[model samples]
Target: VLEEIGIIFRDDAEALALWKEAGADVKGERVHFPKGLCRSLLKTAPSIYTQHARNPDRSVQIGGNATVFAPVYGPPFVRDLDGNRRYATIEDFQNFVKLAYMAPSIHHSGGTVCEPVDVPVNKRHLDMIYAHIRYSDKPFMGSVTAPERAEDTVAMAKLVFGDDFVENNTVLTSLINANSPMVFDETMLGALKVYSRHNQACIVTPFILAGAMSPVTVAGTLTQVLAEVLAGASFTQLIRPGAPVLFGTFASSISMQSGAPTFGTPEPSLVSYGAAQLARRLGLPFRTGGSLCASKIPDAQAAYESANTLNSTILAGTNFVLHSAGWLEGGLASCYEKFMMDIDQLGMQQKFCEGVDLSENGQAMDAIRQVGPGSHYLGCDHTQANFQTAFYRSNIADNNSYEQWLAEGEKTAPQRANELARRWLESYEAPHLDPAIDEALKEFIAKKKGSMPDAFT
Candidate 1:
């Protein structure tokens, strides 16, 4: 299909040719991969890799049996207290960063949790990176809006980790989305080139809203996803050998009735599973799935949809899960309550991933023998010893008696989540950064902003 109808690549023709020359068959503007070419090129890609955080303890191992969770990406509006949905501001962005930092389940402070509409489009990435640097100790994604912004991200990292450290280490991992049905735009390519050249990691994702950007069938969608990611990942290798890259898939089926995109659907989950299999076959870390929902609010619909998607993500063996929280209305809005609810759900998923321990202690043969025949274990020695760590407890869930719940005003899950979000924000403290490095980052941002006129587009 790629050879016959060829993917549209809206970028430098010379660079395109270079990619084609590197084992891909070229016909005019289109490049096709021979049957075994993709697999051959992907052999050099690592099956697993480590993403380093500024705090060594916060570093994460991606791929293999490990999974890393990152928060929502590219939501333009934010829903907050007073139940208002408004254009996200810099303040809102910072608050989300704080929430991500506070939530132990979120491993990476994701890129563009919500567009900071108050900040100029050209300069917002600086503020966003600064927020991640100052507010969170976890690994975070770099800006991919432009190559220059990606360079700014690297420069900021240098200020934080020192010049020598960033030169030899992978400090920032970024998202580079392919225009689905096989097109890669210049902006994304530019950012990918920058990250690859600088030794930073990039998740080469195909942004496929099936039936819109791709074919309606799951098999066709997976084929397109595979082809796109293979081409993108190959291009990264051409840029710089041994560049850390992930094979990423961002796909959702469209609602035929309303001409809208739907998330957390069965079809997308299947596609994600196939995508993970393909990524593993290619010997690259895979990125897919999240706490996705189409609900406008954090209600029953949101809970069920998000749970379905989250469970599919864990089972699919996705290495890096983006948009793992705060997604609502099919990624158009970032709901605060939904963010907290997703974190609570992520905690549960983490426990599930721990799997059943087969150790003697885990078997608890003695405890069972002592209890025997449905006799109470609540008062047994084992129960008393392990009570604190025995069961997974939710911070935001209400598990009280009906009368106790009534006494506490009978707040719903969303209400309780909202309260928890507020408390987290109230108790948030900025993580420490070196005084000189902080000042250097501020100066660099100020100088860069001053160099360019504010451009909203």
Candidate 2:
């Protein structure tokens, strides 16, 4: 089956050279991940430690799509008319994941906010989106940017919101600090001042764009990405032995002709590949968002790009995938229709990768006997048993005739998605918090003076 298909690997000479210049560990095809990260990963085992954040994990595989999903879904606003928007419960997330990653980037300063999902089409909203995210049972994946400066770290840390600003100081202290190379010495001190606060699973990520930041080749990018991961590991090790963290790399590239960074380009694909390798070397969870290719809708472009990224990263073993839905144009904006389409696609790939079994004693002979040498197996029980499980079966992805599709109103993916979101909201119920616990949580949030989402009502 592997021989049935072909793959191409473009060699970027410039990117490779710069990474070597940075004193990265390089081999012919794979780079020896940083030593610091490997040590930490061994200590942490199942957690993300980062000999090289992108390497595939040895014990178990993990992957990511670093999300900017916290922002609003409908008509955008820094703050809504009613103040805060409320989402029913983390049921949607909790049911789907064993753990979910959350990170607030300095990028959020530019109006990148914790946007709420107004599914109930509600009357009230929640004020801070991150707080609701914090209320979840899943762990937080906070990130810090250390670009040689501490102040830069401080600003990034400030994004984590708590009921009261004072109580949440640990939000910044644990996750944000002098933990990454992204923070040039220009702001290291300011970052550490806050780092002394707590101990949570916070990750330091690298946004190494292939030509823009690192050199422009896959090999070079791999080594360069390794060094960046090393820098992050240095911070974690200095703080404690087994610091819970993940390796992050968003190494996109610039379209030589367009002059704009092409996250949807082959560069991002290469980065995904390299990050996975790095994760394996470290024996820890790795990070890099995937499944975003189209500029507008969930068309063919999105499908191919997302599949390529997932294929590479899953092999690499990244932890906590993000940007799982609603993205367009390198994540600049999101389309609801495309998001649902992508979800369907995700289900399909998962089925395809199930891989065929060659082992004996399973019924290969029986299956053949059932159908006979020249007979069709279309109506066989074997076919019926496994048929429905193939790929993501869906109402939106009807393979029915044009007449049948039209009978369903020929509704596009977006329409289907809107209805699905509506259905999810209607079916969702608020999580049951102990009455006293609920009061405490409410009291905590009540002190914060700001807008509250009308949906909460």
Candidate 3:
């Protein structure tokens, strides 16, 4: 279908020509790839790549059986402790950044965790990048809203990692979504051009919400996703061969009755599994699946749906998991309670991914012998040595008996999560940065903001 019907490369003659010169059949704005061409171009892509963080210990390896978790992206509203859903402000964004930094399981400080609507559209990217740089030492994403914003991200990154280091290393990875049903918009393509030229990484994802952006059937959606990502990845390689990139899919289904987008469904899981297999075949890092749900709040529906998606992501062997936490109401709101709940669940998922240990120590034969067949092993030497680290413990879950629970406030999981969120913010301390570099970053942002009039859109 990609060759026969072709895909649209909207308003990007350079990309269209690049595809044509690289063996794709160009018909006006649409470029059709010949059989095996995409696979051949993808052969140069690295199976795994390192994304460096300011704190060297925090750097992450993407692909090759590794799974990295990042928080939610592109939500505009936030649900606070008082259960009020309102437009997210800079303060809300900073708070989310602090929470993400405090969470040990979350490895990447994701871009646009919630859009700061109060900030001017043109300048919010600066604040977002600053938050990630100052508040956390983890690897982060760059802006893709515009080509200029992407350049700004690179400039800001230069201050953090030095210009020479930024040019030589992959310090930032960004999301470059394809307009579904075989279209690549100018804004996204422009951002892709900037990032790929700078040797920064891009996640070429097809934002497919089934029965809307794509066909209702899993097979049909999967085919479209593959074709879309192939084209985007091919474009990245065209800009700079060997530039780091990820084959990404953000597929979800829609409700038949309400026309509402549904997540954590069976179809998305199937697509995620198939997408991972395809990505591995193409020799590129894969990114997909998350703690996705359509729940309005952090309730039973949210927990069940989030668990389903999280498990599917691990089983699919996803490399970089975006929207790993704090997604609610079809990506409209970021909930504090859900963020904490997802972090706790992330700890469990990490344990699950560790698999089983068959070593002699893991067998615990000595402990069994010491306890004997009929005796308890609770006080055995092995148990005593390993009890503290043997199993995964949730920081927010209640373990008290019914009487003890009643004696204390009868707090639910959400309530506990809310308390933990508050504590994280209260205890957060910004990571230190070199004084000269910090001043340079501030100067850069101020200069850029001064040059442009406030753009609210």
- Evaluated at residue 430, the lDDT of candidate 2 is 38
lDDT of 2 by residue, 157-196 (tens): 2332323542232232122222222332323322322342
Q: Estimate each model's TM-score.
A: 0.97, 0.61, 0.98
Q: What RMSD, rounded to one decimal, does every model reach?
A: 1.4, 12.2, 1.0
Residue 212, model 3, lDDT: 94
Q: Total clashing residue pairs per candidate? A: 0, 66, 0
User: Residue 67 deviation, candidate 2, in Å?
Assistant: 15
Instruction: Please provide, for model 1 over 384-442, each residue's C-alpha lDDT reduced to its tens digit, 9 standing for 90 to 100.
Output: 98899878999988889999999999999888888888888898888888889889989
| Structure candidate 1, residue pairs in collision | none
Off by over 4 Å in 3: none
Ranking by TM-score: 3, 1, 2
The parts of candidate 2 lying over 4 Å away from their true place are 1-197, 357-364, 384-391, 448-457
Question: How would you encode candidate 3's per-residue C-alpha lDDT over 11-117 as one tens digit per residue?
Answer: 98898889888889999998888987877777777788899999999999998989999999999999988899999999889888888888989999989999999
242 Cα displacement, candidate 1 (Å): 0.7
Any residue pairs clashing in model 3, and if so which? none
